[model samples]
Target: MTMIHAPSGPNLEQVRRIVTEIPGPRSRELAARRSSALPAGLVSGSDVYVRAAGGAVVVDVDGNSFIDFGSGIAVTTVGNSAPRVVERVIQQLDSFTHTCFLATPYELYLAVAEELNALTPGDHVKRTALFNTGSEAVENAVKYARAFTGRPSVVTFDHAFHGRTLMTMTMTAKNRPYKQSFGPFAPEVYRAPMPYPYRSPGGADEAFAQFELLVDNQLGADSIACVIVEPILGEGGVIVPPSGFLKRIADACRDRGIVFVADEVQTGIARTGAWFASEHEGIVPDLVVTAKGLAGGLPLGAVTGRAEIMDAAPTGGIGGTYSGNPVSCAAALAVLDTIREEGLIDRAQQIGSKMSSELNSIAAATEVIGDVRGRGAMIAIELVLPGTHIPDPDATARVNRYCQARGLLTLTAGTYGNVLRFLPPLSISDDLLAEGLGILRDAIAVL
Candidate 1:
């Protein structure tokens, strides 16, 4: 098979170049400055500050280049500084950066909403409300559900990650850095069992049954306003639920008049080889929360849902001062256009097939790689102790460090922090991806 080459940027080659150490001289200087200037709470995965990035490669301050597999935590599906996104953002910036969409409405905001309504998973009449972050989108989604259904309770699942806001943090399942010491969380939020086939004792069927029991016994369906889930859990590890699990959950929500919410903050926008991950299950969520890849690197989030449910909130009930900044909206419009014009959804599937083949081959030879899972480019390898399912976060961390030292940018996930997740940009070239995977294999081999 012929390998596709990534679009080259000025002074940016697709190959990884480690001129200095992982945190080179300049990066170390910058890290010192960052430590002095910024709060300690803001943790970064890498100390190598990026000077420029395009396609699959990121150039650091000290002239080191790395093959990026994180995509800035799935924020840049189209790649950093994608041509169309930069063009649209520049065009919008030249015209007007921000007039505040709520105060002075703009066509770009409406255009973004229209595109989202049309692109998200559903043929029903849909409406969209924009926000600045995924957490805000999720918060608004819950509000819309409660307002529409007139119920206060919301149900999330085990190993689910909504966002970082108070309400969303409450909805999130992880307890450490995300929820520890965060004070009084919002009430009426309940947790259900998620279908994690790899580690489940009774398998997918029992997991689904457990979820249903949770809804029926712990929190009755009538009291629930929304059932929010990540079709493929992102930060809680790239845990793909069993086949038909999403459909069944959607059906249950529909039957009980509970609003079904798919938090596609990480899995949407062609990241999963589909416009929205919910489409994989043929399930149409009443409301879909989106961010990350929505604006191709800009801070933009959206809640697209059935018109009635979205409209149920009063006119001024759901917007922020910077809800849909015009510049971000323009970037999103370009992102949608690029996705269609570039056939990124197909590209994602191709990347996924390749990554799965390579990673599974490595897993076959590596006992520490307990499971290889995910769809499209959203892939992950859960590390465990040899010959057992026990998590090995130490191995996961070692692999991550090795990959970083070898000039390959990777990310770690899972509630137990034992999963290595890969979110390569959809535009990455096959050769670059192979090189990064080669580094990963070498790292695992050393273990």
Candidate 2:
């Protein structure tokens, strides 16, 4: 089947066909070269090396085409090599790649900043500062919020994955690979309980109550500069909190004069049906940090917030040399336009409904999936010990490998590592979705 292609790219056969072994010969050769040239610490999702990709399919070096369910960890939300992004970048390259936005400003930078300020949740006079990655955006947002509130404390939650930078790694809750010996972490960062409805024995309501009490009693709202949270925890396993939980958090932050930041790095840019995951809760954050899908597949991130809070930073307090590279800014502009012009926001909702229903059906017949949750295309299934809530990381690993070998890309997440997260591109065809989900069902059946 010629799966529905995005506006442009290679004319690839959309079917997931494996012409050779999973890694194939060329990939194995590259792996040997990579081991010596690259650090062993750098982890990769699958063994296949992508030669070309577009829409929901990636052609490996061996000419094997796999269904791209991961979307490069949600960076390719507009789909890889999207025509608009490609055209915009090419046009920018014909003029200039970078003059450094700080040294000699450019129109693309202003255009992107304008787009962000208008597109993000609040209608209040807002300002946006662009960055190169999610970690930089998170760190910059924290610095500016502290500048505005005159407070030192920052609050995050358990089971949160902010990013891999120094300050962000400090904010992140996972320790094994993301943290480990990287500490001497930044100080004054506090952790609240995540309202995980599936794993929390006491339930989401009680967990939120604890979160409120902890912030009020221990951290003290007066000391908090900001409370940063993922509207739907992405790396922590696509955990969707209880309804109204996010709104209450927003309410508390507003009441205390605290800057509430929605770390929409993974959930923003229509990955969750709405423009942002925070919008799904009707919670307009004081600060919204965005990345991932923002630049199609390029590295671009931004921190947008109320004008007063954002302008508190000193003139030179934030911004890097390549923060808003012209090429990346061009791609981001195209990303916003594509999402608007192609109706991908509604597409995400449609994909989510189908995936969620199918996963629920699989859960109904199996003892492995303890829970199925998440909004839009960002969904996951928590594997657990049969008839119990105990995590089953081993089973999660087995299923991931099973899918990977069979031409399906999947990711493993969660604190306990028992959650298999799915982040398929919204541009994926219904036929490919059915075929990929069928492979997933077969993987679970053997487990």
Candidate 3:
């Protein structure tokens, strides 16, 4: 795919101006109210209450315009309140809101399935099942894999995050926030090593060997049902596996008759400059799960895979009351249209190129940044102690706060919590992008 340097357009002012302290008076009030009304377990990265968001800017209640680098945790890929999405959602709302697709089938649901089946990797006869969240779709995919293979064991990779549900949390490797205390997780799930470019010298051969060892010992070939992994590890600090590693695993799974599942929840929908991150590795998974940005800002997840595998489940096996809400389906169709018509596939790569270049320049000047890595708009900087690879979560927190205070919204991730990840919307203008990068540079300078 081609990477274009020029930005196509934006939905809001490119300027980011801070008129007050980070969490201004209005936000403080909201926080106080939230403390009483909501559970303290619900954590927010920023104290600023978002009043409005457009393009790559999230305006707070105190009128602070913060450059958005998180994209609402990789949602709103088409930009918040995208014109097409708004229009379609409004039209759908005017007609009907919740006719539950399972009880009363709608054309919107079928249209979304068609779009996903056509767009996802591979030319096989594909089928799609939509749900309200990524975790649900992933669980269904697991169920389908078990049913199709008649096997009990399922496998996920290290530093991988599938979802917050019981089964997916078991799939996730992180423990503190996602899995801590959420115990008694689903059984028959196994963990394997994913190739980490910065941490592992394995590249592809070592990754393959690890997989072979895992299959041979922990999980017998005949007992294993499927192996699910992200093409690029998302919350695990935007970890991009080495070249050929993904393809090697895919080939192995194919040969072993074990279904290969690609959890593209965080890296799909043109965020990585491709329709799906699997396209980057030229690997066609048996089942691919997608969410986060699928329905613009609306909640939606789709599991698209080979028709035979998806059809393995019973007729009433995988579905829910709000599986495919009409409004969300309409928003998803619009999101797909925006990506296709506006050439976001190439735009995403362009954003990545620009961010990677800028981030590399920063890394050259400081020891705080140990590695600069990612593909397309999904990028990250792994923070470390000066002159060493030891994780520095405190530094990560400090830098994140600096950016937010200076009117730039950034996010932190990774197993060690030392990664500053960037997920700007594909529509971010060149000026805003540069400004956000400048803020990041200044923040790192202080660190």
Could you give candidate 1's per-residue lDDT for residues 1-447 as a string of tens digits?
Answer: 122233344235677888888888877887888889999999898778887788788988777789999999999899888889988898989999888877888899889999998888878999999999999999999999999999999999999998888999999999988999996999999998887878874477877788788778878888899999999998988999888888999998898899999999999999999998998999989999999999989999999999999999987898989989998999899889888999999999999999999999999997999999999999999999999999999999999999998999999999999999999999899989999999999999999
Q: Give each prediction's root-mean-square deviation over alpha carbons.
A: 4.0, 3.1, 5.0
Model 3 agreement with the true structure over 336-447: per-residue lDDT tens digits = 9999999999999999999999999999999889999999999999999999989999999999999999999999999999999999999888898999999999999998
| Alpha-carbon runs more than 4 Å astray in model 2 | 1-10
**In model 3, which regions exceed 4 Å deviation?**
1-12
TM-score for each candidate, following the candidate numbering:
0.97, 0.97, 0.96
Q: lDDT (0-100) at residue 93 of candidate 3?
A: 95
Pairs that collide, model 2 = none
**Cα displacement (Å) at residue 322, model 2:** 0.1
For model 1, where is the 10-residue window of minimal lDDT? Answer: 1-10
**Clashes in candidate 1: how many?**
0
Tens digits of lDDT, candidate 2, 12-83: 556788888988888888889899999889969788877778878988787788898899999989888888
Distance from true location, Cα of 95 in model 1, Å: 0.5
